[model samples]
Target: MVKYPNGTFAAFRKSVGEPTFKKNQKSNYYRKNINFSDRGMTLEQMINESNKFYRLKEIAVVHKKPTPIQIVKVDYPKRSRAVIKEAYFRQESTTDYNGVYNGYYLDFEAKETKNKTSFPLKNFHEHQIVHLTECLKQKGICFTIIGFTSLNRYFVTPANVIAKAWWTQNKSSVTLTEIEEWSVEIKSGFQPTLPYLEAVDYFIADRKSKNGKYKI
Candidate 1:
């Protein structure tokens, strides 16, 4: 059996272990060519890039919350920049990204899964659910971008739907078939490829109509 350097048995695990793909792998190529691919850029990178595009075009303002770093040690070199010698992953205090678009406070999380069917509930945490619930109560436009690696499909599943499912799944895990049914499938394009805001528009329209507050 293959053993990790940490002396843990590695062969029995069905899914790829940590550092599954090489850091320098051709992620951008896969992002451009593969459907529902989370290849080159991480979900955080994709969202940051999209936000940059949006900001450049005066579309909307969005940004990723910087990952807090607890620097335990640093190496100061005489002729170069100081390198982080040791650090621990700090607990995140907020959602992945947030910003404003057309007067709406937008908040969201970007997640990727290798599962061919349904994304596992384990991917999300209770804190995130609580945060999203608070955002919803305040009328923020909250949602998530789910990447299905094996099937090459990306979807925008609204926070409300996710919260309900997440609560129900406390008793059982959600199924892949269920995600396919509820998610708004995204088709990547050239400019602002994901075009997720359009999905947001639809969601807003549906909610307004349901509440008898529809306009235009």
Candidate 2:
């Protein structure tokens, strides 16, 4: 059974309709001159760049999960590059990314919200919650990078905490004050852009201490 409503499905289906030849031509024309500086990157791009930096520095082995796609049509402009003419995105994604860091399994989702008061629960999916629960069962570190666009603040909130609140919210929605009380605030940085991993480290350390297993 489809999880989302038919209207939602129709909207995405309509968006997937083949681009006109003229639109494709225009896209090709602009592709070469597309400037990264002019287009401000998404939070996901910043995280990927930070992951690259971490990899180069021998800190972690993390990368964004590749979007699954089914290529229906392709245009061979030249021998080197094959332009994708038609494609359909595959099954729903479980999480934004997952990998290993310091021998720990790391799984997370990245999200940005414009709401000043609270991060909405609708941003998460049932599949993601199940995936996180499975990961936590195996003692993997599962978390989310929540970006508050209005406040320009970010937080690394654990999946377990979120899950509990999400389930509780079946009766009612979780409030902003609750999130502020539970989540760990992450300060933006220069070199890595978003130093969320630092917050993760601290969270892990604190958890270990509570369990009487803190190490020097």
Candidate 3:
């Protein structure tokens, strides 16, 4: 199923057809429709596309961290192919993505929320929080990219803010107002889709004023 910008879902099907051109046509009649709407892309999908653009432009090197799965059983349906029948997590995974950007070790988790007023803390795992804390202790640039899907808003929240809330506030969720006050709101864009790296640069500059850091 694919979701459009208008909040409607539908099963996607491809149509089979061949291009028919008029005889003696000087130009191609088929026009390529450019969609900047980023239709059917989830928050993660947008980020992934942005990361690809970054990589292509040599702006940053970031990638989604794959969870380590241990296969317990496998089915050999044929000699040339085998499928995993059972598997388990090797251990609790850490963040969603991590990489280096302009000499700073970047580590972050990405999350999407449908709630308009607040973002539930349960969307994050304790292990993930611990991992971010560890990265922070190493002087790494750590943060979270949160998307309020229902509201079409996104924020780049520093890891320190999240750690503080999780350890001290003991709250069930973080209010949207609180997030706005503590995080940098980012706007979606073309080419890269999600322009999160700009917010990252902002974070770097802010950190430099406080602890002396930088960005690309």
- Give the candidate number with the greatest TM-score: 3
Clashes of 2: 0
Number of colliding residue pairs in model 1: 3
lDDT of 1 by residue, 1-216 (tens): 111122222232232111111111111212356432344665556667678888999999988888666777888885578877777656645578899888888899888888786787777776677778778778888888887766666777767656666666243445666655555667554556566776667656656774421111
lDDT of every predicted structure (CA atoms)? 0.64, 0.64, 0.72
List TM-score per model, in order: 0.73, 0.71, 0.76
lDDT of 3 by residue, 1-216 (tens): 111122211221121122121111111111134322347678888899989999999999999999777777889999999988878777778899999899999999999899999988888877677778778778888889888987777888778676666655458888898777767677676767777787777767767774432211
Model 2 lDDT tens row, 1-216 = 123312222221111111111100000112233323234656787688778888888888888988777777889999999988877666666798888877888999998887888888888876677778678778788888887766666677777666665555353434556555556665555456666677567556655774422111
Residue runs of model 1 more than 4 Å from their true location after superposition: 1-39, 76-81, 88-91, 169-172, 211-216
Total clashes, candidate 3?
A: 1
Clashes per candidate, residues 3 or more apart or on different chains: 3, 0, 1
> Using lDDT as the measure, which candidate wins?
3
For model 3, the run of ten residues with the poorest summed lDDT:
21-30
Return model 3's CA RMSD, one decimal: 16.8
Please list the residue runs of candidate 3 whose C-alpha ends up more than 4 Å from where it truly belongs after superposition. Answer: 1-38, 74-85, 210-216
Task: Name the better of 2 and 3 by lDDT.
Answer: 3
